[model samples]
Target: MMRRGLLAEFPTGDALIAAVRALHQEGYSRFDAFTPYPLPAVQRLLGWRRSRINYIAAFFGLSFALGAYLLQWWTAARDYPVIVGSRPAYAAPAFVPITFEMCVLGTSLSVLAALFVIIGLPRLWHPVFAIPGFERATIDRFFLGVDESDPYLDRDRTTRALLDLGALRVSLLGEEAPPP
Candidate 1:
């Protein structure tokens, strides 16, 4: 949907990173940065906490694996015990391969689903797309956006802070900007 925000252009990746850090330190928490390439250091500077997706994926994997194994055990050992070649009906060892496969499958699917949810996928539009010159962010420039939804956001103050952080240009996002 349409929402107001501020977009600041940085001449370089380092400048973008620094600006994000400074803005965050200034207590502006609702913001995002865009760059042409991945910047590992920038992620740490953005104040993002550790992701819990891995843990969630692990939980799903284990649950699915255990369920699969238990189902196999119930069917083989209890429900319909098939004794073949004098082998035991339970056959725990025989279930290992299928259990491992189930674990892998569950982890893969859970992680994929988690990523979609976390990243807000299937979104065909975003406020940033309305910012002029924002396309450069995917080519040669860097961009840092401060969302107007931030409780502490003051347009004048935010613009000033962005300029102070060495932003080459700072402009209010048109589509997302609030009514005057």
Candidate 2:
């Protein structure tokens, strides 16, 4: 038998969040959400955690600055001390630009590297793509979905759950507005 998922859409963030919380209370854990713009309130309600990408990027950037400064100083002042064109071997001004650039470059590279390491980049496909009406997600729509894989999923029961949440209407994703 072909499996189906229930995708509930909402006109606003409040409605979507209310539905999400209600579903969570009903033990619906397997779901993914989409929104046209950020909703700080919903992020809190969903219990989303802070991403470590920023921390990792900052750390890498700091490390790069320190390493670049040390490498330049050590080579010019201590390893093979040589003053070029009457300039001070440890002149700080000359190092500033290169140090700043390296910091930015390293931070950007590592952030992208971390993204690939953490959330596989180039993810050409996802299971949710098989669910109908999901294409609206990129437009002016907000969606909270119950996957067919969810334990609580039964076509009738899921639809009933959506309706109970005061959904404008519940319908099979691509069925063009099912008889509610």
Candidate 3:
């Protein structure tokens, strides 16, 4: 059977931490904490996997840069053979500006595309936004939740559990989870 997500909102950081620890110890493997600012300790608690997009971006950027330079050399020197008043067949200095521009352009464009895909842009809406009292996550609240997608998540039980954990407020979000 499908299950809904549970969200807990805390009034203070200490409360947030305690609730997170409680959930973590309770054998809840799929959970996430959210706050207005960085919470460095959360990573240790969650143990998120390393992201490979950086390596991908580096590989793509380097390939693009080299391809840009080589393309310029081939088109200007060998392929098309443009003669600007006998200024040598392969004038490396003359090609510098366009080559540099293309390299920068290619790297920047590819990186931007990668970022859009990585971050899931153009569809920036999130399930957390639907949680009650969650709008304050940016202002002055801390939140934690078991995603509706979590296999072991039990909607009613999780919501009740969060409320008992000293949540200032508890609620559910997303189409899968009903509003509190």
Candidate 4:
């Protein structure tokens, strides 16, 4: 079933941020904002932080490098010693290039996988597109949305909250507004 929600249009990014912050202070958390341009203040107000993909990539990269180095050492030094040019079997220097390559492979692949999982990719559509005038969200308008799944969400209440916070227009998204 399509989810219903409340949407508020704002004239400016600052206004959207302010409304989001006010709603957040009122114990509303399940909301999102759309702006024509990057708005760090809106992100901050929405409690967005640094992405965890960086940490995941770093962990995978370091682990893969260490594992590759160990495998090389074990193979060269213990499993089957190969004395080339009278050099030591466990040549740490020789493993550097392969280890670096393994690190890069691990980091790139893990980051790609994490992004797909975290961002919920592969979807062609979202219900937010049903909001009136939402198409302008990418052009000139700033929008604040309160999802229906939010525990505190109430149609009338949300409408009033957005209106009180200076929304230019408040609309019910994903569902038709009830007749007055």
Candidate 5:
């Protein structure tokens, strides 16, 4: 199988953060870090931008609300005109409640769907999980994983750089076990 990536183990969160910073400076953008706790520094170094979920939510919410209002208006005015209490057939005020409810429903559902799709939810497995000792990432150890597809990735050089950055060990990650 093709190489997946390289996983480097760091003894401390600081070391992991430093390694990420150095790699970023060295023009490595396709890497990820794992730590027992959140590291704002690492996140910044990774250059993650704000999520687009809000835009998605707004788009879907407005679209649904408009559709609901149009449907209500069409039903009242054209589809099945109902003359009730001498009110106009396409009464905008009467559609307010359903339109607002549809807006809320669409916003919430879109946010949930966007979050799931962005994060690849319901994932049962990841290649990182196959790396021995990686479980420590949830407890104490911090890790930096460099993707093989990175333009700057040269296995030997990356391993050396990671080791120089105070990595305890660097392992090849793929479908098969790393070489001894």
Candidate 6:
């Protein structure tokens, strides 16, 4: 099967960023860029939003902490009344340490889960990986890949635009069969 996308190699990050900006301005939204290192400019031009991992962590953390506190209170006061050191059975202050610990645990675990889900973890292969010299994405090259599904994509016109934007090479990626 053929992969329906165009992958272009740029001489530098600047060229890739320019191409992304140009594509975005041209109403092309279904595209991604790869580079040896993170480029905030490229991200900004791509209009990528901040991740919601922090919100997920916070929600889970606070929820777990509250649950921990309530569990402790119910066990000590209502479930089975217990009095130690002449303190009240439902000592809110005493539950602070465990509550905090549960909060941290929840935050970490939720963040891990969110990261996995957000990144589509366990994905060991991608069509781009089949492209020759694409491994340079991690070493010293910048790349822009425009999905054929993009509404503004005209294979011929986009190819010409990429070349005009100083792309060193442009390739039409072929799809690779998924691992069984």
- Candidate with the greatest TM-score versus the true structure: 2
> Residue 97 of candidate 2: its Cα lDDT?
89
Worst 10 contiguous positions by lDDT, candidate 6:
171-180
Q: lDDT for each of the candidates?
A: 0.84, 0.74, 0.74, 0.84, 0.88, 0.87
TM-score of model 2 (CA atoms): 0.75
Give a tens-digit lDDT track for model 2, residues 70-174. Answer: 988888877987788899888888888889999999999999999987877776655546556657667777777676777977889878777777665554543
RMSD of each: 4.2, 5.8, 4.5, 5.2, 4.9, 3.5
What is the RMSD, in Å, between candidate 4 and the native fold over all Cα?
5.2
- Better structure of 1 and 5 per TM-score: 1
The prediction achieving the highest lDDT against the true structure is 5
Candidate 1 structure quality by residue, lDDT tens digits, 39-135: 8777777666788998989999999999999988998889999886789998889989999999999999999999998888988776677677889
Q: Is candidate 1 or candidate 2 better by lDDT?
A: 1
Q: Which of candidates 1 and 6 reaches a greater lDDT?
A: 6
Candidate closer to the true structure by lDDT (higher is better), 4 or 6: 6
Question: Over the full model, what C-alpha lDDT does candidate 1 score relative to the true structure?
Answer: 0.84
lDDT tens readout by residue for model 5, 1-180: 123889999999988988998888889988888889989898778777767789999999999999999999898988999888999887889999999999999999999988988988977666776788999999999988898889999999999999999999998888675334
Instruction: Give per-residue lDDT, candidate 6, residue 120.
Output: 83
Candidate 3: residue pairs that collide: none
- TM-scores across all candidates? 0.72, 0.75, 0.68, 0.66, 0.63, 0.74
lDDT for model 5 comes to 0.88
- Runs off by more than 4 Å, candidate 1: 1-3, 24-29, 36-41, 83-87, 132-140, 149-168, 174-180
Residue lDDT tens for model 6, 1-180: 124689999979888888888878888898788889999998887678988789999999999999999999899988998999999888889999999999999999999989988888977777887788999999989989888788888889999999998998889875666557
Ranking by TM-score: 2, 6, 1, 3, 4, 5
Give the Cα RMSD of candidate 3.
4.5
Report backbone clashes per prediction. Answer: 3, 0, 0, 0, 0, 0
The residue-by-residue lDDT of candidate 3 on 73-149, one tens digit each, is: 89889999888888987888887777677767767787788878886787745666665567788989987767777
The runs of at least 3 residues in candidate 5 whose Cα sits more than 4 Å from the true structure, single-residue gaps closed, are: 1-3, 10-14, 26-29, 35-44, 47-53, 76-94, 112-124, 133-141, 151-157, 163-169, 175-180
